[model samples]
Target: MLTVYAYQKCSTCRDALKWLRDRGIPHEVKAIRETPPTVAELESVLSGTGGDIRKLFNTSGVDYRELGMKDKLPTMDQAAALELLSSNGNLVKRPFVTGDGKTLVGFKESDWAAALG
Candidate 1:
């Protein structure tokens, strides 16, 4: 089963969940704001995105802006960045899904279909 870390208030998260349900894809949903992904999971996503750590972030989020991640990210090392993200779920992208050796960020229907299918 896939594990999806999503915020309830996020429309994108809702959409992703709906898509999964519509397809009958087995998955577990966790509130991203309360339970962020672990470093290991983040690492998997990092690897999946070809070592682009920025892809793992919710760059448009308030937390991202307030924390100055955009300016700070370039100077931060992988370990430090992952630690910060793991500690604060708000900094993570919505609809973070991981399972079956696959990792996906955000809610792109086509991407999800291709990955989960």
Candidate 2:
């Protein structure tokens, strides 16, 4: 089953949810702000995403800037990055979805269709 980690107020998350429903895709939604994914889960996401750890971050979020992750990303290791993300679910990317060994960080209808297909 597809698992979606999302924030309630995020438009992207809402869009993704709508997209999934419209497509009749089966998915389980989790409130990321209330319960963040674990390091192991993040690692799995990174691995399935072809090692693009940056894709796992909410780059446009306030948490990203407040933590100075933009400037410190280059120096961070996977473990450190996961630690930061775990500290605050808002720091992690929105509408994070995974299923059948596939990981998607954001809502892209075309991409999701292809992946699900």
Candidate 3:
């Protein structure tokens, strides 16, 4: 099953969920703010994103800035980055979705079509 981790108040997240529903895509939604993805899961997503750890971060998020991840990320290893992401959903990008051996971050309609189609 497709698993979508999203923040309830995020407009992007809401739109992504609506898009899925409109397409009749089978998926399960999780409240990301309450239950962040585990370290193992982040690892899988990183692999799917071509090993780009930065793709997992919510660059515009308050937590990302407050924690000073911008400069810290360059010095941190993938393990450390994943650990940080697992600790706070707000720091991670919204509408993170994975299923059928595919992983995706954010919601781009064309990308979703290619992945799910």
Candidate 4:
């Protein structure tokens, strides 16, 4: 089953949900703020995404900026990055979806369609 980690107030997340429904894809949605993903889960996502952990981060978010990740990302280790992401759900990308051994961050309609197809 597909698991979607999303923030309720995020328009992108809402759009992603709509896209999933439109495509008749079944998914389980979890409120990111209420239930942050674990390190293991993040590891899976990172691996599935070919180790582009930066893509899994909410780079533009206040939490990210406040945490000084913008300047520190290039120097941080994977473990440190994952720790920061796990510390604050808002610092992670929205609409993080994983299933069928595939992990996707953010929502691009074409990308999602291709994945689902």
Tens digit of per-residue lDDT, candidate 3, span 4-36: 999999999999999989999899999998999
Residue 71, candidate 1: Cα error in Å is: 0.7
lDDT of 4 by residue, 28-64 (tens): 9999878878888889889867788898898889888
On residues 3-51, what C-alpha lDDT tens digit does candidate 2 reach at each position? Answer: 8999999999999899989889889999998888878778888886788
- Taking the tens digit of each residue's C-alpha lDDT, what string does model 1 give over 1-117? 899999999999999999999999999999998999999999999998999999999999999999999999999999999999999999999889999888999999999989988
Decide which is better by lDDT, 3 or 4: 3
TM, every model: 0.98, 0.92, 0.96, 0.92
Better of 2 and 4 by TM-score: 4
Worst ten in a row by lDDT for model 3: 94-103
Superposed Cα RMSD, model 4 = 1.2
- Which parts of model 2 have CA positions greater than 4 angstroms off? none
- The whole-model lDDT of each prediction reads 0.94, 0.86, 0.91, 0.87
Query: lDDT at 20 for candidate 4?
Result: 85
TM-score of 3: 0.96
RMSD of each: 0.6, 1.3, 0.8, 1.2
Off-target runs (Cα >4 Å) in candidate 1 are none
Q: Per the 3 Å backbone cut-off, how many clashing residue pairs does candidate 2 have?
A: 0
Q: Which candidate tops TM-score?
A: 1
User: Could you tally the backbone clashes for each prediction?
Assistant: 0, 0, 0, 0
